[model samples]
Every structure is written in structure tokens, then in C-alpha cells.
Target: MEYQAAPARLSTLDANFEHDFAQRLHWSADTDAAIEQRVADILADVQKRGDAAVLEYTARFDGLQVDGMTALELTQAELKAAFDSLGDEQRDALTAAAQRVRTYHEAQKRASGESWSYRDADGTLLGQKVTPLDRVGIYVPGGKAAYPSSVLMNAIPAHVAGVQEIIMVVPTPRGEKNALVLAAAYVAGVTRGFTIGGAQAVAALAYGTATIPKVDKITGPGNAYVASAKKRVFGTVGIDMIAGPSEILVLADGSTPPDWVAMDLFSQAEHDELAQSILLCPDADYIAAVQREIDRLLPEMPRRAIIAKSLSDRGALILTRDMQEACAISNRIAPEHLEVSSSNPHQWEPLLRHAGAIFLGAYTSESLGDYCAGPNHVLPTSGTARFSSPLGVYDFQKRSSLIEVSEQGAQSLGRIASVLAHGEGLQGHARAAEMRLK
Candidate 1:
């Protein structure tokens, strides 16, 4: 089938630009009510029945009939065998990507994932104690595609943060296991592996099954069922984020090749039909060139139909008044992946404040960041980048405030606490503080 992708073309000077732009950026993260209720049922059932529920769901949903959870479990020996079974090229690439991700996360851990305290003049020690989670469950999507990269992006950071156990859960529909995924689990230091998925896997992770052991937190992306389960189970166990459709926004200055920008847009659009890819450029001719390139290159893509629908539905090619205006619009969008495909990306990068991750120059494509470029591919989507952040070592670790008040410090602090406690009408709190005072 022939596929054509013509993203909406809008000029910033137009009177209806705001309305048109708003319409293009609109994407609802609301899950279907039916899915929510079904997920709730599944979570409750798994929470109640434990391994029996997990086994039933694995057979019913994944078509993998196992005798018990033990049969569904991937042994460490299996993971190593998968790693050994890979070709030299696959093994080499996986090793290289894992090393880069590990190195970047190690630096991130050192920069922020450490405990520190300081003593004041009164010998009052105050700071924070940063610690890794005891264990974490990483959900890798194994339905339509195998995401070895997802395994690396999610588990490697937790390992770097000193997480002792990284439990991995991937849905293997029809009992077909992806070797690369198993190899990635070996490479990423996954402590346990389960060939199960959907809300059932999430439930098992969130509320410990008899076999699968509960985790302190769960990370990684999954389908809508998994997402709904995560949203529901947030209070019981921590989740990375409730991710939406993928997004990429390009701020161009007309200097870089339009084909590169077009392909970069395709990179995100190919993720799914709802994924968004937009380009904001000051030059009208450059925008036209990108459109031509998108048309020319999209036909060559295997997922051209998906790319076409995504670009037609949510994508835009806006003609900005200038690069400054482009940067402002990029900030407003706060896309999951922002690419400054310009001559001097750094100049505009400073002006751009909100983005999950910024790709700094024409050479830096969003795909590079998605795979081997060190930084995490898991990012806040659907304008959540305005306040949230990309997944990192910090997500896998938590901090506790450290405070040790000396006698002199306590005397000063006690009076202040007593006054505040009394002001708040908490007599017990006030009395407790007064009791500590000299």
C-alpha cells in the first residue's frame, strides 16, 4: 500500500495559530473504563490467589500453559545461555550499549545518589541519606516487539544505584522467547526473570506472589493494561511514571539538512499511530523541504503506515517567526524528545527549559538517544516534561533527611517547635517539645 504523510502546516503569524496548534498537540492519556475495571479485577485476584492466579492468566492471556510459576520462571542459567547463544555482532552491540548505559548511570549515582551530612556551629548534623531500593521490578514489552534496550534502560540504572535485585517481567505471547531480551537481562544484572506480562505481571510485582517476590518499585513501559495496573498500584509500590504516547519536537534554524530532520521526526512517528512528531522552523522553504523529504523517505520505511497515520493525526510543521519563537513554542510543548537541529544548538538550548531530553546539534538524532547514547530513553510524555523528568538512577533510589540535634541545638529548636505546635493548637506536640527544653 502507498503511504503519504502530510503533517499540518501552520504559520505562527496566523490569527488561528493558537487554536490550530492546541488541536495538534492534544492527546488524551485516559485509559478505557473497561480496561481499568478489568485491571482492578486482575490485580485483586492476583493479590488474593498469588501464584495460582498468575499461572491461570499466563495460560489464558499469553497462551503459555505452565504447570506452575516455576515453569514460567527463567533460570539464571537460561539467561546466560541466551547471552551465549547470540551471534558475535549482537553480543558485541549489546555489550557496548550496556557499558555506555552503565557508565552514564554510574556517574549519575556519584553526582546525586550518595549520603551526606554536615555539622553546624551547635554540632547539629543535618543532611540527607540517599539509598537504593531493595528490589525493583522492570516490565519489558514483549508483545509486538522485543525491547532489549528497554531492559538495559530500566535495569542498569537500578543496578548502578546499588539495587540488590532487579526482577524482570516480559510477556512472551505463545511461549516464544526473544533471545536478545534474555541476553539483555543477563547483561543488565536482572536477578530473576518471569515470562509473564500484562496487569497480572504488574500485580505479581506490586503485591508479591508466592514465587515472584514483591519489589520496592516497578519501572519500564508496557501496554495500557500494565499502565492502568501501575496507576492503581502506585501507593502500594512506587512506579516510574504513567507514560503516554511517545513524542518528538524539532526546533530547526534552516541550517541542517531537511532529510535528517524528516527522518528524526519519522523515528518517533514510527513508534505508533498516536505518537507525535512536530517541527518548528523559522524558514518556510525549509519546512517545505522537510515535507518533501518526509514524503520521499517515508515510503522506504517498513512501518510507513503507522508513521503516516501518526504524522497526519498529531504531527505539525509550524513556521515560527524566528528561532527565539521556536524555542518558546518548544518549551510550551515540552515534548518527550526535543531536537535542536540547528547551526548552534547550544544557543537555543538554554532558552528551552522544558523537555524530557534535549538532543543538542544536527548530528544528535533522537534515535541515538533512544538506543546507545548513554541517557535514558524512558522519558515523561504528553507535556508532563513540564514538571517531571526522564528516568534515572535517582528514580531507583530514595532519600531520608538526617538530623542530629545537640543539647544547645535542641534548646533553640525546642522553643521554636513549642511555639509552632501551640500555635497549631496541638497541645501534645507543644508539651513534647517543652519537655525537651532546658
Candidate 2:
């Protein structure tokens, strides 16, 4: 099939630019009502029936029939076997990527995941205690594609955060497992694993089955059903984020090769038909060059059809007034992955404020960050980067405020508390504070 990718061409100077921009950026996160209802049923059944529900759903959804939950579990020895079965090159690459992810998360832990306390003049101590969750479930998407990278990105941070147990769940459709994914689990120190996925796997992790231990949190991206399950079980068990389709916004200054930028855009567009790739450049000629490259290069890609559909549906090649205006628009978009494809990326980086991850310089592609660049690739998608952050050591750990009130400090604190309590007409609260006062 001859694939064509013609992303919407728009200019910042266009009269209806705002309307067109909004339309391009619009992607509703609403899950189908029927899916939501089905997910609820699954979650409730899993909570009520435990292992039996999980097994039944696994068989129905994944076509992997198992008599008992034990058959579904991926034992530690099996994970090791998967790791050892790999060729030297694959094994070496997995190990190297794991090490880099571990190193980056370790540094992140040191920087922010530490306990600290301070004492005031009155001898009152106040601080925070940082502690990791005892157990966490990291879901690896096994459908459509096997993400060994997702395994690394989700599990390494929890391992670095001192999470004691990392339970992994990946669907093995028709009883087939991805060796690379299992190898990643072994390399990332997954404590337990199950070849069960979909809403049932999420329920098993969140509520716990007879065989699957409950997890404090669940992290990783999945399909619509998985996403709906996570959203439903948020209060019961923590989730990473309800991720949307992948996105890449390139802020180019026309200094980088148009082919490189075009391929970079393709890197994201090839993920799925719904994925978006946009380019913002001031030079109209450079934008033309990029489109030409996209035309020439689309046919060579194995996933050319998907790339073509994605670009045609959601992608854009926007012409901004200048680099500064491009940066402003990028902040507005708050893209999941922002690539500053410029000669001096640092010059425009300060002007940029919101992105899940920023890839600086012409050579720094978003794909590098996805696999071996050492930063967590589980990022906030669909403009959630405006307020949210990439997954890190901090996500696996929580903080508790520590307070030690001295006798001297209680006198001052008591009076203030007493006034507020009395003002609120709480006699019990006022008396409690008074009793504490010396």
C-alpha cells in the first residue's frame, strides 16, 4: 500500500489559529461507558471471588487457560531462565539499560527521597519521614507490543526507592511469553510475577487473590480496560497515571536536519494510530523540507500504515512566528515529550516550562529517553505535564510529617490553638489544648 502522511499545516498568524490548534490538541480521555461498566464488574468480582475470578477472566480474555493460580505465576527460577536464555547481545543490552535506570533513580532518591528534621529555638522538632511502600505491582503491557522498556521504567524506580517487593503482571496471550520482558523483570528485581493481565490482573494486584499478594500501588500503562480498572481502583490502591496516547512536539529552529526531525516525529507516530507528532518552526522552508522527508521516508517504515494514519489524524507541522513563540505554544501544549531540535537547545530550554521530559539538542531523540537515557519514561501524557511529573523514586515512597512538641513550645502553640478552637465553638478542643499547656 502506498502510505501518505500529510499532517495539518497551520501558521500562528492564521485568523482561526486558536480554533484549529484546539481541535488538533483535543483528545478525549473518556473511556467507553460499556468498558467502564465491564471493568467495575471485573473489579467487584475479583474482590469478591479472588483467585477464581482472576483465573476465569484470564482464560476468557487472554485465551490462556490455567487450572489454578499457581499455573499462572511466573516463578523466580523461570524469570532467571528467561534471562539466561537470551543471547549475549540482548542480555548485555538489558543489563546495561537496567543499570542506567537504576543509577538515575538512585540519584533521584538521594536528591529528594530523604528524611529531614529541624529544631526551632523553643526545642520543638518538625520534619518529614520518607518511607517506601512495602509492596507495589508494576504492570507490563503484553498486548500489541511487549515493552521490556516499560518493565525497566516502572520496576527500577520502585527498586531504587527501597520498595521491598515488586509484583509484576503481564498478559501472556495463548500462553506465550516475551523473553525480553521476562529478562527485564529478572534484571529489575521483580519479586513475584504473574502471566495475567487486563482488568483482572489489576484487580488481583489491588485487592489480592489467594495466590497474588496485595500491592500498595500499581504502576504502568495498559489498554482501555486496564486504564478504566486503574481509575476505578484509585482509592483502593494507588496508580501511576491514566496515560493517554503518546505525543511528541518538536521545537525546531531550522538548524537541525529536516530528515532527522521528520524521523523523530515518525518515531512517536509509529507507536500507534492515535499517537501525535507535531513540529513547530519559524522557517516555512524548513517545514516544507520536513514534510518532503516524511513523504519520502514513510514507505520505508515497517509500520508505515500506522504512521500515516497517526500523522493524518492528529499530527501537525505548525509554523510559529519565531522560536520564542514556538516555546510559548509548547508550554501551552505541555507535551509528554518535548524535543528542542535546535543548534543551541539550552537557549530555548529556559523559556519552556511544562513537559514530562525534555530532550535537549539536535541529537537527543525522545526514543533515547524511552529506553536507555536513564530517566523514567513513564511520563504524564495528554497535557498532564502542565501539573504532573514523570514517574520517579518519589512515586514509590511517601512522606510523613514528624513533630515533637517541647513543654516550652506547647505554651505558645496551646494559646494559638485554644483561640482557634474557642472561636470555632469546640469546647473539647480548647480544653485539650489548655490541658497540654504547662
Candidate 3:
């Protein structure tokens, strides 16, 4: 079958540009009703039946049937063996990437994950005590593809945060485990790993089965079922985010090679049909050149069918009035990945207000960040970047405000609290403050 790739074209000067642009940036993270219901039922079953339900669902969905829960768990020795089994090149790359990730998160921890306190004139000591979670479960998606990088991205930060135990779950459908995934777990300091995924894994992590210990939080990307399960169990446990499809927006000054820009768009498009890739530039000729490159290079990709459908359906080559306008549009999209593909990226970088991650310069590709650029690749999607931020050491650790009031401090604070408590008509609360007064 012949492959054809054509992306939608838009011009900022068009009369309907506002409406057209709004339509392009729209995407909902909401799951289908059927999927939500199925996830709820599975979660309830796992909550009630525990390991038995997990085994049953793993057998039905993953086609890996095992009598005991022990069979599903992978030991540290097995993970080490997987790491040792890799060729020199694979091991070198994995080690280098993991080190970079760890280094980055360690720096982040020192910067923001430390406890701090201050004392007032009245000897009122107040501050925040930062502490890591006792245990965390990281879900690594194994179906359709293997994400060794995800293991590094999710686990390394938690380890840096001083998390005591990191439990990983990755589905090995048909009992086929990806060596690199296990190797990543070994390198990233995952305390334990289980070959289980889907909503059942999430449920087990949230509710704690006979074998799988309940975690304080669950992090990582997953399919519809996993996302729905995470949403349902949010209060019971912390989740990273309900991530939407991958997206990348490139703001070009028409300085980089057209092929480079085209490939950057393809990087995100290859993820799935819903993935969005857009190019915004002032040069009409450059936009045309990039379109030509997209058509020329897409046929050579292994996932050409997906790339084709994604580009045809959601991708766009937008001609903006200028670089400033391009940045404005990029901010509005608040894309998961934004590439300032220009010589003077810094000149325009200050203008970008919202983006999951900003890839600067022509050489900085979004793929680099996805694999080994050090900053976390688990970013907020679906315009959530407008309010949230990338996952980091802060996500795995919590902060508690410390207040130690001196006798003199309590008298001042108590009077303020007593007046407010009385105004709210809570006699017990006002009396409690009065009791603390000097």
C-alpha cells in the first residue's frame, strides 16, 4: 500500500484563524464510559479478592497464567542478570542515561527537597519538614512498546528523594519480558518489580494485596484503563498526572534545516494517531520546505502509518506573522514539548510562558529530552502545563509545616485565633485557643 502524508495548513492572518487555532489545540483526557466502568469493576475486584483477582486479570489480559503470586515478582538478582545480559553498547547507553537522570534529580533535591526553618522575634519557630514517601509504585507500560527510559525517569527521582522502597510494575504479556526494562529497574534502584500492568496493577498498588504492598503514591504513564484507575484511586494514593497524547510544537525562525524540523514533528507523531505536531514560522517558503521534507521523510519511518494519520488529522504547518506571534501561539497550545528551533532561542525563550519542556536551539531535539536530557520526561499534558509542572524530586517527597510557639508567642496568636474562632461561632475552638494563652 502506498503511503501519503499531508498536514493541515493554517495562516495567522486568516479571518478564521482564532477559531481554527482553538480547534487544533483541543484534546480531552476523559476516558470512555465503558472503559471507566470496566476499570472500576476491576479495581473493586482487586480490592476485595486481592492477589487472586490480580492473578486472574493478569492471566486474562496478559495471557500469562501462574498459580502463585511469587511467580509474578522479579527479584533484584533477576534484574541484575537482565542488566548483565545486555551487550556492552546497550549497557553503556543505559548506564549513561541513568546516571544523567540521577545527577539531575540529585541537584533538584538539593535545591528544593530540603527542610528549612525560621524563628520570629517572639521565639515562634516555624518551617517546613521535607520527607520522602515510605514506598512508591511506578507503573511502566509494557504493551505496544518497551520504555526503559520511563523506568529511569520515574524511579531515579524517587530514589533521589530518599524513598525507602520503589515497587515497579510492567506487564510482560505472554511471559515475554523486555531485558532492557528489567535492566533499567536494576540500575534505577527499584526495590522490587512485578510483571503485571493494567488497572489491576494500579489497584494492587493502591489497595495492597497479599503480595503487593500498598504504596503512598503511583507514578508513570499507562493506557486508558490505567489512567481511569489512577483517577478513581487518587485520594487513596497519589498519581503523577492523567497524561494525554504526546504533543510537540516547533517555533522556527526558518534558520534550521527543514529536514530537522520535519523530524522533530515526526518524533511526537510516531507516538500515536492522536499525537499532535505543529510548526509555526513566519517564512511561508520555509513552511513549504518543511512540508516537503515531511512528505519525503515520513515514508522511511517504521511507524509511517501512524505518522501519516497523525499528521493528516492533527498536525499543522502554521504561518505566523512573526516569531513573537509564534511564541504566543505556542504558549496558547501549552504543548507537552516545545522546540525553539532557531539560532537565538534565548531571545524568544523568555516569551514562552507555558510548556512541559522547552527544547532550545536547532540541535536540541525533543527526542533527546525523552531519552537522556536529564529533565524528567513525565510532563503534564492537555494544556495542564498552564498550571502544573514536570515531575521531579518534589513529587515523591512531602512537606509538613512545623510550628513551635513560645509562651509569649502563644498569647499573641491565641488572641487572634480566639477572636476569629468566636466570630465563626465555634465556642470549643475559641476555648482551646484561650487555654493555650499565657
Candidate 4:
């Protein structure tokens, strides 16, 4: 019934210019050589020992003493019954969210090309074939908080992309999965789960064990250690992204209520102390109003201390001359989530070029996108969106080129192949192609 207080309207406004807000973007690599080496050592142990190493690290890192391997593994029956435990409302919500995510990802499914053959002077057929990854691992963070939504967001797409197996890892301090998480997993149709977490869980997923099978790709979000682990393990195994702390950039022209702006910013801030929320507006008055709103709202919210630190240290308001400058700044930052609360969202949407996800207008808050919205929340952060994209069905699939060379095709293709090989002075390669022609 009650909500965080909105900012009281100010009698006077400061229209001063402050473009200095550009300097705030900073993200440093948190793990050093020693930390990375330590993770590598633990990963080696997991790869060699399998379940024994996983349990050992679980005790050391998560502080949960484990005696055996099966203790951490969830049964299929347990996964099935998890859905019954949830109330009707929660179950219905999970079902709807799953459907929405499925629809969005299904639309993104790209069909595999069919086998084709044609005649060149010598006749050859060459094309690409699309195939899905056989298995993938989804890491869901827990301990401080639980996100059932994460289970839905990560698993359903992999399933839709036709991945054969989905193995999940969630850090459970109490050695138990969240009921909602289990319920979401059930709806998402994930079969196996492991309780062990931290860098060791990543290691197990990357390099299979007697108990835990290796995965082709790993996708999810976690702490700095998790990000660092993902970075190190790339090439050995595929990853979604090395996500930075969550961030949101709200570009408004003071049309929305200060309360709306404050809450949008707070949603990201509450994620972690390092999470950042910025407001870029042409109105300095709106900046002041939102600052007041943040102060009023902080005390009432559950994660008050966390939100306060995040806002003071990472939050900022950049007063721009007009929408043009604001658009430039938004593209420069390339925020994980961009909310265009300007005069016209449709007009501004085209002007923006980079973002993990775009939330147009005040009505489309980032929170909606986090939950029921079809777009993935596992987005590129810390400027990676400039080159990367949000995790989607494609992330769980692989593309292969299809080639069929007849004797005639090989004869014709071999001449060109041999020329390139000979030009590069690879005698063996040139001879191999020439043999097909002979």
C-alpha cells in the first residue's frame, strides 16, 4: 500500500551546464595474477578429481561442508515436484514469463540451410549448415539473493535453440535450492542442477568430471570472481559475456515524474553497491528533483545502505544543452539498459546506436524487461555492448559450413586451391588438392 516518497517539487531550478559527467565511466579488472592463478589451480583440481574437487571447493569457498557428491545434486523427481509447491499466483506468473521468453526466442530461431548441389565448370556445392550446441551450462547466482527469473531467462532460450542438455549451477549457502528457482527451472524444463558454485563450478562445467559432464558453453551472471573466471575460461569453452555490474541510463527531458525517474534509477542501484544509475537530462531542475527523490526513497527501500552507496559513488546527472548532446552521451556510454524518457521515444530510438537493451518511454521501465519482457537481461555491460549483444538463442547454437565436392567439382576447385597453397609455399597442401584432380 505504501511506496518510497517522491521528490518534493522545487520552487527554483538551476539551469547551469555540467558536461563533466562524462568522466564517471570506469571499470577496472578486479582480479590480479595471483587470484587468477589460484582459480586456475582450483580448476585443475576439479578437472582431475571431478566430484571430490567440487565438494572440496564448496566447503572452502561457500563454507558449506559437504561429504559426498550426490548431496549437492538435485533429482529429476524433486525438480518435478517443485512446481506443485508454488502458489497459484506464482505458478501462473512463472508460466506466463516462460511463454513470453519462449515466443521471443522462437522468433529469433534461424533455420538451417538445406543440402544443395550445382555444377560449376567442374561442378561444386558449398554452403553453411547451422547446428545447435549439444549442451550448455547456466550459472545462477545465489547466497545474497535468489533470482527465479534468471532460471527462466537462461534456460528457455537454450531449450528453444535446441540445445540437447542444460546443466544448471546455483550457489546455495544452505545447500538447498530456492523453491521459486526450482519452480522456474521446472517450467523452463532444466533437468540437472548442482549446488556447488564460485570458480570451481565454472571449472566443472568447462572440463567434465566423473559426476558433472563438461558443457560446450556457459551463460549467466555473478560477482567479480565469476566474471574473472568467465574471462579466463574463454576459448576452452564458450561464454555469454563477461558482464560488469548492472547499469541504467535514463534520458529524460523532465516530462516524467521525479518519482518515476528515481525508481528507475533505484532498480539498478539496488542490485549492488557497484551498480550504476545515471540521469541525462536537459533540465537541471529535473536533476535536482531526482536527487531529492533518491534521498527520500533510500530510507524506505529494503536495501537502503546498498542503494545509498551505489547512488553516491556511481550515480550522476549530466546536464546537457539539448537532446542532441544527451543522445551522443548515451551512445558513448553504451549503457546496458537505456531508457529514453525524452519528448519522443520513437524519434530518439533511431538516434541511439548502442545498448544491450533499449527501453523506450517512461512506461517501459527496465524492471519490466527484467521480468516478463521477452528480451534477455543477461546483457553486455561495461561498454561491451559496443561489440557484443544480449544473450539469445544464437548464443547456444553453432554454425557450420556445408561442402560437397564431386570428382568434377574437386578437379575444378583443386586448381584454385592449389594456386593459393603454392603461393603460400605449402607444398603438402598443394599436392593434397592436386591428387584429387589427378
TM-score of each: 0.99, 0.99, 0.99, 0.90
Predicted candidate 4 versus true structure: per-residue lDDT over 380-403, tens digit per residue: 999888899988888987877667
Off by over 4 Å in 1: none
Q: Flag the better candidate by lDDT, 2 or 4.
A: 2
Stretches of candidate 4 above 4 Å error? 1-19, 32-34, 111-123, 406-412, 434-438
Instruction: Name the candidate, 1 or 4, with the larger TM-score value.
Output: 1
TM-score of 2: 0.99
Clashes of each: 0, 0, 0, 1
lDDT of 4: 0.83
lDDT of 3 by residue, 1-438 (tens): 667778889999999988988887777777899999999999999999999999999999999999989999999999999999999999999999999999999999999999999999999999999999999999999979999999999999999999999999999999999999999999999999999999999999999999999999999999999999999999999999998999999999999999999999999999999999999999999999999999899879999999999988888999999999999988888889999999999999999999999999999999999999899999989889999999999999999999999999999999999999999999999999999876
The residue-by-residue lDDT of candidate 2 on 207-319, one tens digit each, is 99889999999999999999999999999999989999999999999999999999999999999999999999999999999999999999999999999999999999999
What C-alpha lDDT do the candidate models reach, one value each?
Answer: 0.95, 0.96, 0.95, 0.83
Clashing pairs in 3: none
What local lDDT score does residue 345 receive in model 2, on the 0 to 100 scale? 95
Error of 2 at 187 (Å): 0.6
Task: Report how far off residue 346 is in candidate 1 (Å).
Answer: 0.9
